[model samples]
Target: MEKKIRFVNGEQVQTIGVFAGSETLRGYRRDVATITTTGIDYAQAVALFTDGAKWSIVEVGEEQKEKVYDWSSHGVAGPITDNRDGTLIIKMGKNNTVEQDLQDKVDTARQETAQAQAVTEALAGQGVATVEAAQAMRMMIENAAALLPDSEAAAVPSLSKSWVVGEAVKPGDRRYYAPTGRLYKVREGQGHTTQADWTPDKTPAMWVVIDIAHAGTQDDPIPAAKGMEYEYGKYYSDPDDGKTYLCKRIGEADGGKIVLHYLPHDLIGQYFEEA
Candidate 1:
């Protein structure tokens, strides 16, 4: 209710009447500096600042008096009283959570960096593999991919035959990315079975690949067919369980491990996998 200098961060003030100057108030961003020698009592000081139009200033009350505090950085910090004391009584929390937080952050970073380094070293050693090993891996992939009928009928390992499972894809069955972005079919039983095994409609229930890109919302099923589109054999949500039908019309997502439709809503369930 009365006038007083507000606490703020800035250089000390020396002028007296200047505190009341209209221009002075505009120039000041925060608290006005009052010399300890003002000799005005708390009530008197409050009245002065109030009259000067300093609505922001408030008189320091008994409750606001400084008190002795034990700080982590400095032992016993300050005592309650009014005076020109430069010292600040920092009350340190019994448990120095700040220190613990900093330590935890440092430890986490160190662990992560160490793990990365270890992985890098291990992989660095495997930079080069034998031609035989490469050939063996090629054979295995060929076998797996062979299960899927290749549309191009491309030779093995030459980007002719792709991979798929019975043409229809299921949720979580598997996703693959070939060197070439061609559509390959995997064998049936590798993907999900549609909820409705009804006869083929006008479309013959051909599978098209679709990516939901996310998991369905809390109340809704996942969405599918978010990103790129492609042709596939069968569309399914889960071939193993045969619980749901993502979509019969395949986008570009099926065959490898992508879905045609994200079950409940494609937008809601889009990309829920990577995250």
Candidate 2:
């Protein structure tokens, strides 16, 4: 359930839509038109009804839309209604968790800036002044770029190529082996020599599955079950293993056949059971 706070006090708007029988806080009716509230403050309008908190008003007629209205405007609003779906609704109000989340984001941004500043200051002390040098220093510090000098270590071979012994493998690093059309993710820090040591099915503890079970080129997309029209944005289950695949994008393949962009592991089955 997601309850959104559409409007708040002190919000600036270009224009407001008003309909027939619109009431003022002083109990006077006004005609319908697209009125501007640029000069008028939000806290000065009268509410038409006092049944509950006036939070929003519905713009009726051909196009039904929700607009923000404060107590200062003679707009209609009622108590918060239950709109439960799958996601838990986080309405921003007094002492809500959403405020805490926002604060956490701010704190994270500050910490990241501080880390980057520390790296920049260290590089500056080393007489490195160029923007590219500063960015390269930050990347090295963050372990995003390999720090091993060219002479010290040979080029890190791609996963599609032969395995290089003693290569530093980090957690969550993914690689695809073209020979077997298999993909593997690093689970722990380990060195690999032979190709079999990195095979996904053989080394379960050392690697994680990160690619689609079926792989092919865009021109020759993988085929689904016969007569199965893959609908866009729909989830389909593999009868063999019960794994779910989501159809994201549809594109034409050879001979004008439609191919779906496959996204794995949506796991929407827990929410409802198929009859």
Candidate 3:
């Protein structure tokens, strides 16, 4: 490789060697630099001082090359290369720079890998797949978070009360009535009914809430309980009519009973009212 001077930030700097030194086997020149540091591991690009020459170590190598600069960078010391194994063979450079440069590259790569793995793990936690997909999902989430107000963004909304009327009765589910202030521990989930006319008060066969309001209709027979957990901005499959609904608010039934207010999930932005 032919040795030429390099420039950095629009300033004229020395051009020590192209790929450094000289090789008789193959005279292929490359625009690269090497540096060696002892004990200290340099992970990123940084300024190095040696023999009144300030060099910016760009690449780090694990082997020896006297006349070959592995990579090139624009800096005060012109072009420099970093070698990791012991010392680097430069025309007139020290192994100190090489060590530091190699260490820096290794450390930087390790850190980047760690960060990528962390992101992947987080995405996996959310059931997202693939690195690219995870990244896209994360970007979307970040954008969404940025759009929300500080209080809203920072605060994670959660329902302290877990019981939902429509949810299938599970052994661990709690059966509670705010009006009566009664909490019942459902032993066997089977045959316990909590639906209207078939509520725990009536059937107690299955801990299921019967939707008496929409009973015997095409709507979902299951009734949602008061104070059931619901998430805003999420699509919920309404058992009624097998249609999807978007929960809008926690409202009340005819008797001021807690219920979820929802709209058709596929509804577009428009005005509508009762005739």
Candidate 4:
């Protein structure tokens, strides 16, 4: 039997294959005849077979070009350019490691900025200038050192261990003192043997006194009292409300002594805030 020629859109063609399946074109699937034609260009073939529908012709295994993308919102540093040939060229500002380093620097800068803002707000609340507050803090620290006793008069307790000379100590090591009956913690990065002159009370820079009653922790906050010196950023409990507050500022120095003018209740929003 002789093969019969098929007609599509008024054009004679040969139907190579026919099956109960669909073919996708330009992301759209349509049920249409797949025909082979001779002596016809792409435009002529589409006009004859597609019947004024939008269609494209390609050889078998030929890939279609994808649409260009807008890479501006991708968060990549520097400019990105489409080369129009199925390739993109990106001019990066830095490599992956350098990019991570830049991100870390940005995070550090934000934290510093937040701290500076807090300091500025604290100064604004108390009507005290930055220089005056800083000078008061410096004098308070200096006078506190001069007030330290040369040696504790009380004898060392039998249960508590006395600070022996040439004893090995590292940072964060705690030792009990007989005079104040308090423990002192070594300063950070200060690992050394005990020295006779560098006692816990005498050397405030190397050792910090730990008061269990006024530890500045959430559980045991320093009680708010008049004439009691409060450290900045330490937690304090208000006697009036019994709520915990963080000390944002301390009273100015008077005669080389830190004198707290207002209690935690009166100093709320000025020198203290809810912790």
Quote each prediction's TM-score: 0.23, 0.22, 0.21, 0.25
Q: How would you encode candidate 1's per-residue C-alpha lDDT over 1-275 as one tens digit per residue?
A: 12233322311211122121111222222222222324444444333333222112234337575322111221111112244443111111112234455777999999997776565446445532455754565566555654644322223334223333344454322223353332323324334443344211111133333234323332333322323232232332332333433322324354444433333234223422221
User: How many clashes (backbone N, Cα, C below 3 Å) per candidate?
Assistant: 60, 4, 49, 0
- For model 3, the stretches where C-alpha displacement exceeds 4 angstroms are 1-100, 123-129, 151-275
Which stretches of model 4 miss by more than 4 angstroms? 1-160, 214-246, 250-275
- In model 4, the worst 10-residue window by lDDT is 67-76
What lDDT tens digits, residue by residue, belong to model 2 across residues 1-275?
Answer: 11122233423322243222322222323321223222233332222123232234324333444443433332323222122331121111211133445777999999998786776687557756567987676556435313433212222312122223445566645454444444445655643443545454456556544333333233323333322234444344544455555444335222232322222332234221221
Error of 3 at 157 (Å): 19
lDDT of 3 by residue, 151-261 (tens): 343242111132345545655444444443333334453634345454443333343232222222223322223323333333334433445443333442222222233
Give RMSD to native, each candidate. 19.6, 18.3, 22.1, 25.1
lDDT of 3 at 91: 31
Number of colliding residue pairs in model 1? 60
Ranking by lDDT: 4, 2, 3, 1
| lDDT: worst 10-residue window of model 1 | 14-23
Task: Report the candidate with higher lDDT, 1 versus 3.
Answer: 3
